[model samples]
Target: MTQRNSSFPLTRRAALAVLTSALAFGAAPRVALSSSPLDVVATTGMIADAAMRIGGTRANVRALMGPGVDPHSYRQTRSDIVAMTRADLVLWHGLYLEAQMEQFLADLGRKREVVAVADALPEDLLLSHADYAGRHDPHVWMVPTLWAQVLEGIPDLLAAQRPEAAEDFAANWAAHKTELAELDSYGSDVLSRVPEGQRVLLTAHDAFGYFGRAYGFEVIGIQGISTESEAGLNRIGELVDLLVERGIRAVFVESSVSDRNIRALVEGAGARGHEVGIGGELFSDAMGVPGTYEGTYLGMIDHNVTVIAGALGADVDPRGRLGKLATGS
Candidate 1:
């Protein structure tokens, strides 16, 4: 197979249209099933993590994007193409989350089994992007309950490819679903501790609309839904004014996004006689470093809810749910 150029697919709409046409015409690519351990290639760590949990030892999973890597602007590398092409299955979070790589992935999909896991979610359950028409927010993992619903079918999909391991996959899926339910309950309970009026979650980018909707916090972002969208000085000034007027004590920065804009917000607020502090860095587009609790999907959301609640004057266990938070992370 000839490898395509490893460049960003800036013209996403046109490329996506072609891919959709192929699927509609029944010419979409299909991966050949094999009896060997299923090889899975996922675009983001969160997807890769889910694949590992569901597939267990029956499959090998590889993630193209790691901690602090922003998928919105991520382009495929030469190695990424090789891993994706060789895989028995490929998973990506659709809904324009991988804006830059959409064309390449779509092209790849014409030849193999590629699925946008979050696409399993019903239309009514998704939040429409505020700035882009016809696009839904892709950060569905922020809400554990919503994310669990999206993941429910994954184990079955993997099982279908490797029926011998179906029983193990089913067990893993059930356990994961249970843990996610608990995580959601913990988040809701802890976040609710903040006063209703002061439950404002301001961040560098608008990646937490689902989180805000799931919990009661009002989410404001310096940038639009996609980090690809630019934040202007006017936007900064307006947010700063809101912070001062509302006496918002804490605003957040994102692990994947630059904190330059967040600093501006803090400085802008200071200039106006209001002292605002950076609440904590939230895992918006990526999880924490691997080999730790925060690196996992459960840990990532746990850290977020804990940090948000703690910063906003809520009483939470300092040890956190999993008791593995790095100092000041």
Candidate 2:
């Protein structure tokens, strides 16, 4: 377990209480008058994507954290606070993913329909956090199968807000579920092509535990589950030695995390005559630009799988599964 640089104060139960009270108070009044699209504010892009896809015209979704935004350290802006408070439904990925925004979201939940979507995931499927005693890692989106499971109940959530759109939400989710299954298949197929010994995924943080588990990769992160964790020199040195000893050629950088530590590993490996290359930039905590394919959940995982496979010497199309990934991505 890597050392955590900071610790958050609010427990999951207390945070839920704040949000639950708000939902209990806010939901009843709005249920009858939800003819219009539900005004939904999500804390992260991934949640916003699901809301948009499943909620469709039934939800007017706005994501606070955008491309390249790091949710682990994200704080609520004044405008963000305004948007969330005014929205009909507020969706956040719980499990302390929004470490900095927990207290504020909890407080705002007192006045709004705030819900942590990820909290609905089964505890048995979750990986316990290395740094936090009772908390699970918040990056379940890495595994398409697990992500599908997390999203399975989203239609009911959307339907709760707009009962009239329940059928529509379910229809959309059924289609989305098929897409998720295809994504899982594609990921499994491609990642399986990597040789067993080379099936090591080294990244900036331990965000890929689920990915590694779902596929057959060994994951190593310089920092712990939370980006708030620090990677000391000794830790980096150990990884460098591992790289040299194992002949691991590539390590990945993340879109939302600093690449400085990854570069350090490259430099350290170079000094030891084992040249390590940056595998590619993976979307760990954030997706790509909104208009692009990589911006969507499917494309995000597709890009990761394609890049990881291609870099690790597995045969894969550079354009990725849908062949819609940007060239050089």
- True lDDT of residue 83, candidate 1: 96
Residue 129 C-alpha lDDT in model 2: 62
lDDT of 2: 0.90
State the weakest 10-residue window (summed lDDT) of model 1: 1-10
Q: What residue runs in model 1 are displaced by over 4 Å at the alpha carbon?
A: 1-35
Candidate 1 lDDT, 55-160, residue by residue in tens: 9888999999999999999999999999999998999999999999999989999999999998899999999865867899888999988998888888888987
Candidate-wise lDDT, in order: 0.89, 0.90
Best by lDDT: 2
The TM-score values for the models, in the order shown, are 0.88, 0.89
Question: How does model 2 score by TM-score?
Answer: 0.89
Which tens-of-lDDT digit does each residue in 1-329 have in candidate 2? 22332323345568778778868888746644658888999989998999899998878999999999989999999999899889988999998999999999899889888889888888998898657678898899998778888888789988987888899999999999899999999989998998888999999999999998899899999999999989999999999999999999999999999999999999999999999999999999999999899999999999999999989989999898889998764
